[model samples]
Target: MAGDYVRLAAYTGIRRGHLLRLTHHDVKDGFLRLDRTSKTRTLQLVPLHPKVLSVAQRLPLGISDDGVRASWKTAREACGLEHVRWHDLRHTCASWLVQAGVSLHTVSEVLGHSSLAMTRRYAHLAPEHLADAINKLT
Candidate 1:
């Protein structure tokens, strides 16, 4: 579970289940390949951070998503993150991307979000980003 947290924090980004299900073969040129894209009508390839790749090297080539989800859920609860959901880790990823000044479109790609509208939930947390954007429009 420590491994899962480290992997989740360092990886391509959430959909932890998606990451858990990823096989070594999924890492490709410039992106972490997804077998399916649910929210987005089209397929996506998330650019992987080197840390994610490093973590991947430690796991078995193909780990089951269900096991990862169950283990992560249980472990987080034990660690007193009683309310944490796997999806919230995804949200944290999005929020971090927003705060770090990554463009909305790029964050959308990182999180496999279908649109910037969906990415807007974290916009308020970017500290001066919205203000900067508003200034541009003025």
Candidate 2:
């Protein structure tokens, strides 16, 4: 049902193309070694959430982008998740990390964003954490 792919996207925030291009050698010691061919055009070592480590560890290296997209569309429609694109899983990953109190800088690194600005969009999800940070200044 594409749950494995969905889980990886939601936990790693890796782009569809990167995920499709992933090979076993790219993952080791809980980090994904993304190459320069990725969307960011930078090499990155994104940490894998423990919860999804098994999925990523076993991820097959042969999946194609079109195959995943078609399967995802069908799976989402079947699950009544309308309007949810494959990329939305990455957004969900970022949003969840921010909500869970992970720093934007860390999330930026995991998402392979070149700068903090690209990760700022998830800042709103951590407002309470931000407020707590300000409170600690008192």
Candidate 3:
């Protein structure tokens, strides 16, 4: 299940509490519908990559998403990572998307954030993402 834990962190970027509460129904055909415990009372539906889809398709009914998350810390450390909290995966995913030039609105929606206000925190990453704003003067 250590591998599943890695997928859980890599896929939905969900925190331990919400991941634990995940039921079989949460893993649908194309999306992972996360009812996040955080503020904003929003339901997040992130598109599942093909790899994630394959994993979700094989999850036994009523499997605990949280147990996987909890197990990940030890495994991650064993894999030679340090101070790598679960939340760090979320940041990593978001940062990678931002660096890839995905729009902020898209990132906000994917993260299930209520507004771009929170997503904007990563806005300054990767100078290329901001080149459009800076290039207007030319």
Candidate 4:
């Protein structure tokens, strides 16, 4: 269950609180409708990654915050990844999207970030895109 939660979070970039609040009804039309988010408290529709489509189907993840914390702690200790926080999974998603050449604007939308500035932190991950744009000027 915790593994599924991690996968869903990593794939969709949804916050832990928002993910916990999700229900089966939230999954529809190839998107996960987040009625409210912790940071912005606004509605967002995050597209479901094909890899996590099966995992998203089992919504209302059924794990309490404490349960997730415990599992994360155990997993981190076992794997010597104690420095990694659960929120890092969200960062991982953003980094992957940026590295894959997805535009910051699109990634910002996908992450439901209130501003594009919030997504800029991942821009450095795709320096090649910047270079490509510079090359186009030639």
**In model 4, what is the error at residue 54, expressed in angstroms?**
1.4
Candidate 4 whole-model C-alpha lDDT, 0 to 1: 0.90
Query: Candidate 4 residues 43-95, lDDT tens each?
Result: 78999989988878888778898998899899999999999999999999999
The residue pairs that clash in candidate 3, if any, are 19-66, 20-66
- The best-first sequence of candidates by lDDT reads 4, 2, 3, 1
Clashes of 1: 0
**Candidate achieving the largest lDDT:** 4
Question: Which residue segments of model 4 deviate by more than 4 Å?
Answer: 37-41
Q: Over the stretch 1-138, how does candidate 1's per-residue lDDT look in tens digits?
A: 446544654455656656666665766674666766455556677776766665554444344656666677678878999787667767877777777888778888788776679987887877687677789994
Q: Who is ahead in lDDT, 1 or 2?
A: 2
Model 2 worst lDDT window (10 residues): 58-67
Clashes by residue pair, model 2: none
* Per-candidate local distance difference test: 0.67, 0.82, 0.70, 0.90
Candidate No. with top TM-score = 4
Ten contiguous residues with the weakest lDDT in model 3: 57-66
Return the TM-score for each candidate structure: 0.76, 0.87, 0.75, 0.93
RMSD for all candidates, in order, please. 3.1, 2.1, 3.1, 1.6
Give the least accurate 10-residue stretch of model 4, judged by summed lDDT: 34-43
